[model samples]
Target: MKTQVAIIGAGPAGMFLAHMLRTEGIDSVVLERRDRDYVEGRVRAGVLEQIAVDVMRKLGLADRLDREGLVHGGTNLSLDGEIFHIDMEKLTGGSTVTVYGQQEVMFDLFEAAGPRGVNIVWNADNVSLHGLDSDKPSVRWTEEGAQKELQCDFVVGCDGFHGVSRQSIPDTVLRNFERVYPFGWLGILADVPPCNDELIYANHERGFALASMRSPTRSRYYIQCALDDRLEDWSDDRVWDEVCLRLGPTAAAKVVRGPSFEKSIAPLRSFVAEPMRWGRLFLAGDAAHIVPPTGAKGLNLAVSDVTYLSEALVEHYRERSAAGLDNYSARALARVWKAERFSWWFTSITHRFPNMDGFDRRIQMAELDYIRGSENAQRVLAENYVGLPLD
Candidate 1:
């Protein structure tokens, strides 16, 4: 098979890029190592930035999201037995975040692209790229125990951080920046309603806790734990108690606990790879960078990457210009670094360090107090939380 673009993943970034290219009359195909069910069922962030929401609407993919998503104007931060709200809508001149799952976004992308003949090959095996730096680049993969090949004008690696795309680049050319935190988040998804109207992030002497939701009736919650902590270590009741104690009186008063249906522990990390592009093989989303989930920038950053790549390819095919593609890496990396900074800062402030001394705790207390009291601090938090406007 031959195509203009070969996207190596069926996740939101790769799938959305294929749709965008299609609307521009560019031909592309999507390849996935996993089936659609696995891809769509994976739990991820539910927050959508305004730009991402707008893009979905532009693609005629916002009907379900608009009807089901919960729009939040603000979030609460709890510290020292006090919880304060940061009104993102008011601080950011009317911008707010929509609580729509990443899986839902994938569903919309799939539905929109299906009738239009978006060729996505699921369960492709041994997917690898060849001659990316040369014209007539090709991708090779195994399907149903048979070897297959695809020639393309470009190959995009949206397969994520553990994907083959980034590793395909030569070690000498790829520079990596990474920080693995000393702790992890033990998260649970329950059938109970969320305790608060908005998300609550709590920092107390015990640890950090978060009360979030996938919907009004389905709550997702998390508590910080040691890096070596196992899922078996936490019981449903114990998790709820820990969350309530850390969140304090105001936010915990509304608690509605139930048996947790799913539980997992995710280690926190901030990582970035310099130059998101190598030859005709471009990296997007988690394949290029990863941010700790504290600020909810992971999925949004990937969308912005698609936003940039889509425009670049459009300019290339329509105007016969390569300027956008040429500048893609620098542009994406600039935004990537800012998000990394925010996530790193937010994670540091919210999570308890094992080695934190009394002085460090005092400083954290003061910083929390100042952020709650100062409009400037609130604005900073709000702007980053709602997302910086996509460049």
Candidate 2:
């Protein structure tokens, strides 16, 4: 097969980029190691930044999102039991975030791909890139024990951190920066209403807890846990008890306990692979960077990466310009680093570090106290939380 671009992994980043390119009359094929059911079933980010929402709408994919997404103008923060609100909408001049799950976003993208003619190869095995340094780059993979090759002008790695895309770049050309947190997030999805209309991030004496939702009736909750904590150690009742204790009186009073359908623990990390582009291969989404879910920037950052990438590809095809392509890495990294800083800062202030001393705890509290008391601090938080502009 031959195409203009070969996109690895059919996750949000690759699928969204495929759709964007399709709308531009650009031809591309998406290769996935898993089926659609697996990709769409992955439990992921539940918040949509303004940029993501805009991209979905721009691609004519936000009909369901617009109808079902919960629009939040502000978010709540708790320093121990004292809860405070940050008016994000007012602080950011009417910018707001939508509570739409990443799973739902994938559903919309996949559903539209067929009618829109976005080609995808599912269950591709041993996917690898070849000749990325040359103008005629190609991708190879095995499908059902059959060998297949795709000749394309360029290859894009959206296959995520563990995938072969980033590793395809030479070790001498790549530099990595990473921080793996000592703790993980023990989360549960239950069929009950959320304790709060807007998300509440709590920093308690015990640990950090987040009260979030996938929908009005489906509550998603999480609390910090040991890095090696086992799922068997946490029963529904015990998890609820810990969540309530950490959330404190006000928010916990509204908490509704129910049977949890999904439960898992995810470790936290901040990672970035520099020079997103190497020769004819480009990287986007989890393939290039990862942010702790604290600030909900992972998927949004991917949207921004593809947004820049699609633009660069469009310029190359439409205007015959290499300038945008040359500048893609620097442009995407500028935004990626800012988001990395925000997610890191937010996690630091909200999560308990294993080595934190008395002074560290006190400083964390002081930062939260300052944000609660100062409009300037709230504005800064709101600006980064809603997401910075593409410029």
Candidate 3:
């Protein structure tokens, strides 16, 4: 098969890239290792920055999101029984975030792209990319025991962190930077009402705990734990008790019980791969960089990449100019690094270190107190949380 662009991975980045390409009259095919059901059902990041929401609405994929997604103007940061509200609307000139799961966003994009004549290959396994430096780049894959090769003018690597796309680039041309945190977040989605009107990020002597929700009836919460911690070691009762302890008395009053569905531990880390492009192949989303979930920047960063990449691809194809494509690495990196800094800042302030003693705990509380007392600090948090302006 031949196409103008061959997209690896059917995640948000790849799917949104195909959707944007379709609008620009560009032909592309998306290949996914997993089936449609798996991709649509995976529960992950749930915060959409203003830029992400705007991009989806502009792409005509926000009908369901507009109807179902929850909008928030601010979030609360609680430390040592004190609360500080960072008003995003006030700081960003009316910009606010939408609380909608990444899975729902993928569902909308997948459905929108299907009827537009985009070719999506689900359950295509062991896909291999080759000849990126040659005149004809090709993708090889197997589906239902049938092996085939596809030739394309350009290839986009959006296959995520563990995918083959990142490794496809010659190791000689790549530089990697990574820092793993000492802790992980044990996230849980329960069928109870939310503990707060908006998201609450609490930092206490015990650890960090986040009070968030997926919907009016379904609450999502997380507590800091060891990176290797398992759900089997944390029963429902233990989870709730820890959540209550870390959140302190303010959140204790709002706690409720319900059927819990999803439970997983996510390690905190920051990862970036330099020059995001190799020959005719470009990397997007988790293929390029990764940030911890503390600042809710993961999904937003992925959306930003495809937004810029699709625009660059369209410009390159139409004007026969590689300027946009050539600058993709630098342009995307600016935002990526800013988000990396923000996520790290938030994580450091929220999570406890291994040797954190009473003195360290007091220092954290003082920092939190200063943040709550200072308008400039609140503005900084508000701006980063709502999102930096998309270039």
Candidate 4:
């Protein structure tokens, strides 16, 4: 097969790119190692920054999102059981975030793919890139015991962190920065009403806890845990008990206990692979960078990455300009690093390190207290939390 672009991975980045390219009259194919069911069912963060919501609407994919997604004008932060609200909308001149699950976004994208003529190859195996440094690049993968090759002008790798996209870049050309947190988050999804209308990030002596939701009726909650914690180590009752204790009495009073349908432990990490573009092969989403879920920037970052990428590609095709393409890395990284800093800062103050001394605890408290008392501090938090404007 031959096309203008061969996009690897049918995840958000790739699929979003495909739809964007299609709307621009560019031809592309998306290759994925998993089937649609598996891809759409994966659990991911539910927060959508303004940029993401705008992208969805621009692509004509926000009908359901507009109807179902919860828009939050503010968020709550808690320090040792005391909660304070940050008026994000008012602070940022009406900017807000939408609580729409990634799963729902994928479903909308995939559902619209066929009618919109976005081509995708599911269950593709051993996907690999070739001739990335050349003007013409190609991708190859195995499908149902058969070999296939796609020749394209450019190949985009949105396959994520563990996928082959990042690995395809030579070691000499890539520089990595990473921080793997000592703890993980024990998250659960239950069929119960959320305790709060807006999301809450909590800091307690025990650890950090997040009270979130996928919908009005489906609550999602998480608490920091040991890296080695197991599913068997936490029962529904125990999880609820710990969540309530950490979130404190005021919020916990509204918590509704129910059987959790999904539970998992995810290690926290901040990672970034520099120089997103490698010749004709470009990387986006988790393939390029990763932020801890503390600030809910992972998917939104991917959206921004591809948003820049798609614009670059459009300029190359429409205006015959390579300036955007050439500057893509530097431009995207500028914003990526800012988000990295915010996520790191947010996590640092909210989570408990293994060796944290009294001074460290006091410092965290002081920082929270400052934000609580100062409108300037709250505005800074609100600005970062709702996401910075795209450059």
Candidate 5:
């Protein structure tokens, strides 16, 4: 197969890029190792930053998102027993975030991309990038035991951290900076209404807890747990108990627990590889960086990277200019580091460290207190939380 661009991975990053490029009459092919059902069923964070929502709308993929997604003007921060609201919209002059599932966003993309005849090869195996540093880059994959090859003007690695794209780059050229936290988020998905209207991020002596919802009728909650903790050790009852213990009486009293449909422990990490671009090959989304979910920047960051890359490609094809493409790595990384800092800051303040000493706890408290007491601090949180402009 031959195309203008070859995309690996079918997650939001790859999906968004393919669709965005398609809208510009650019032809591309997507290769995914997973099948359609698996790709669509994966449960991921739903907090869509303002820029992500705008991307969906701009791509003509926001119909279902508009009808179903929840919007939050602010978020709650619970320190000790007091919950202080950071009015994001008010502080940022009406900036807001939409709560929409990543899976739903994929649904929107597939709905449009499929009928338009966008080429996406699912269940592709052993996908490899060749001649990335050369002008004509290509991808090779196995499909139904048959080896296949795709040639493109450029290759995109949206396959994520564990994927092959990043590894394809020569070791000496790539530099990695990473911090893996000692704690992990023990998260659960339940079919019940959330206790609060807005997301609540709670910091307590027991641990950190978050009250988030997928929809009015579906709730998603998380509590900090040891990295070694296993799902077998945490029953539904136990999970709810820990959540309530951390959130305090006022918030806990409102929690209506049901049988959890999904439960998993996600280890937190902050990771970025310098220079997202490697010759004709470019990395976007989790391929280039990863942010802890504390600030809900993971998916949003991916969308933003896709947005930048799409524009760069459009500029290259439309104006026959390489300036945007040439500057893609530096540009994406600039926003990436800002998000990493926000996620790191938010995670540091909200989560309980096993090694947290008295002074550390006090500092965390002081950070939250400042956000609560000072309008300027709240404005910073609001702007970063709602997301700084994609531009």
Candidate 6:
């Protein structure tokens, strides 16, 4: 098969890229290793920055999101039974975040892109990338025990961290930066009412606990723990007890019980692969970088990367100039690093360290206090939380 661009991975980044390109009269084919059901059902980041919401709205993909997604004007930070709210709109000059899951976003995009005649090849296991240095780079794959080759002018690798796209780059030209935190988050989704109206980020001597909900009837929560921790060891009773302990006394509210899902742990890490381009192939979304879930920047950052990448690809097709495509790495990196810093800062402040010294603990407390006490500090958090302007 031949097309103007070959997009690997049917996740949000690749799907959105294809949607945008088609709008510009460009043709692209999306290849995915997973089936449609799995891609649309995977539960991931739910928070959308103002910039992300606006982009989706402008693209006509926000109908369902605007109707079903919850809009939060602010979030609460609690420490030792004391709560402080960061008014996002007041501090960020009218910016707000929307609570819409990544799965829902992908579903919406898939629906929108399908009718536009975008070709999606599911269960296509990518074998290799060939002819990257040439004008036409090809993707070799197999689907249903049959080999196939997709030839295109440019290839986009949006397959994410574990995919083969990143490996295609020569080691000498690639620069990798990574940091693996000492802890992970044990996340659980329960069929019970949320503990609070707004998301509560709590810091306690035991560890960090986040009170988040997907809907009025379903609640999602997380607790910091070892990377190798297993869920089988922690029963439902133990999970609730730990959540209550870190969250403090229920007071007017109470912890509701329901069928609790198995706990899953995600190790904290921040990673970035330099250039984001090798020859005619370009990387987007998780294929480029990853941030811990603390700041809720993962999905939003992926959206931003594809937004810039699609625009650049369109410009390259129009002007026959490589300038836009050439600058993709530098442009995307600026926002990526900003998010990395924010995620790290938020995680460090909320999670207790195993080797945390007295001075370090005190400093973290002081920083939190300053954020709650000082307008400038609050604004800093608000701006980063709502999102930096997307160019």
Q: Each model's TM-score?
A: 0.99, 1.00, 0.98, 0.99, 0.99, 0.97
Full-model lDDT, candidate 5: 0.91
Cα lDDT, model 5, residue 335:
97
Clash count, predicted structure 5? 0
Please give the range of 10 consecutive residues that has the lowest summed lDDT in model 6.
250-259
- lDDT for 321 (candidate 1): 97
How do the candidates rank by lDDT, highest first?
A: 2, 4, 5, 1, 3, 6
Pick the winner on TM-score between candidates 2 and 6.
Answer: 2
What tens-digit string does per-residue lDDT give for candidate 3 at 323-357?
A: 99999989999999999999998888888988888
lDDT of 4 by residue, 273-328 (tens): 99998899888999999999999999999899999999999999999999999999
Count residue pairs with overlapping backbones in model 4.
0
lDDT (0 to 1) per candidate: 0.91, 0.97, 0.90, 0.95, 0.91, 0.87
How well does candidate 1 score on lDDT at residue 295?
81
Residue 121 miss distance in model 5 (angstroms): 0.3
Give the number of the best model, judged by lDDT.
2
RMSD of each: 0.9, 0.5, 1.1, 0.6, 0.8, 1.4
Location of the lowest summed lDDT over 10 successive residues in candidate 3: 79-88
Report lDDT (Cα) of residue 284, candidate 5: 94
Q: List, residue by residue over 1-391, the lDDT tens digit for candidate 6.
A: 8999999999988988888888899999999999999999887888899878887887789999989888998998877556788998888878889888888899988888777788999999856899998987999999999999989999999999999898899999889999999999988889899888678888988899988888777888888988778888878888888888888775114668667864688898999999899899899999989999997998888889989888898888898878889999899999999999999899989999889989988998898898889989999998999999976
Question: In angstroms, how far off is 351's CA in candidate 3?
Answer: 0.6
lDDT for position 39 in model 4: 94
Task: Compose the digit string of candidate 5's lDDT tens values, residues 271-296.
Answer: 99988999999999999999999989
lDDT of 2 by residue, 125-177 (tens): 99989999999999999999999999999899999999999999999999999
